[model samples]
Target: MPQATKSKDGCINQLKIAENHLSGNYQEKRESYDKEEQLMIYLSKGHSPNDKYESYDEILMPIGALLNNTLNYQEKNEVIKEYGLDDEEFKERMRDMCNLGEALELEARQEESKRKDVEHVRNIIDEFHCSLEKAMDILKLTEKERQEIMPYFQA
Candidate 1:
């Protein structure tokens, strides 16, 4: 079997494992071909070969679109041909892109969390008239975080 097929199979197996952990109808039904087909077509509409995604959401949306197609036997082959890549090569490239996307998402989440933490620390200082050290200790903030939030308090 092709590596793409193997990967798809692996993904399915993992999904099955996930389903086992769920308690309800959230487990996907293999018999729901019509619903699955509709979902595939709907997802594919977001991915035109010539279009470029501009924002973070635009970039992230296509990963689901690509993944929906990538798991299908015919669609995956078509995608490989569309990219002019061999099976193994496309697989490697897809893996790299997925990793990069995941890293970017992680960084974005961490930044947002840090911003919220800084705001919370500032609130603690303002509401209680506490020292910066006290706020830092309460929030478990690091020296770097203290330096970053200090300027806002100064102004």
Candidate 2:
């Protein structure tokens, strides 16, 4: 952009343009600063990820450990900072939580898969327990051969 150097009837129009440009830059910087402060606040309180978190949030480890296990939200942040997780434990716990979430998803699938298989196995065990199998075998044998059947004990 070319600079406006002419004094247009004693009016400095270029200064207004320059001021607007600087003002826009300042506003952008201020907005970014405010967002950073908000993220820091949320991290200190063990908050979950924001809807519009950016690069800094990805690198930040948001883990919290409570010594007493009974502190409220505000107090938990102080204790988490006091312990100073060194980030490794923070990352580990986050991974563990992710694993648990995956396990839960598998559990949902397991229920669908094991429905008939589990029921069939249970029915077989119940039918073989103690008297049921013994009575069936006796019925299959002749009356004279029934005396040869031995009693089975329940485990």
Assess each prediction's global lDDT (C-alpha) against the native. Answer: 0.55, 0.39
**Each candidate: how many clashes?**
0, 0
The C-alpha TM-scores of every prediction are 0.44, 0.24
Report the lDDT tens digits of candidate 1 across residue range 117-155: 778987998999998789889988888887877776675
Residue-wise lDDT of candidate 2 within 1-155, one digit each (tens)? 11212222112122211223444434444443443322221223323223223433323322322322223434434434444643667646644655565677788786664453334434544776635445535345444333322222234
Any residue pairs clashing in model 2, and if so which? none
Q: Pick the lDDT winner.
A: 1
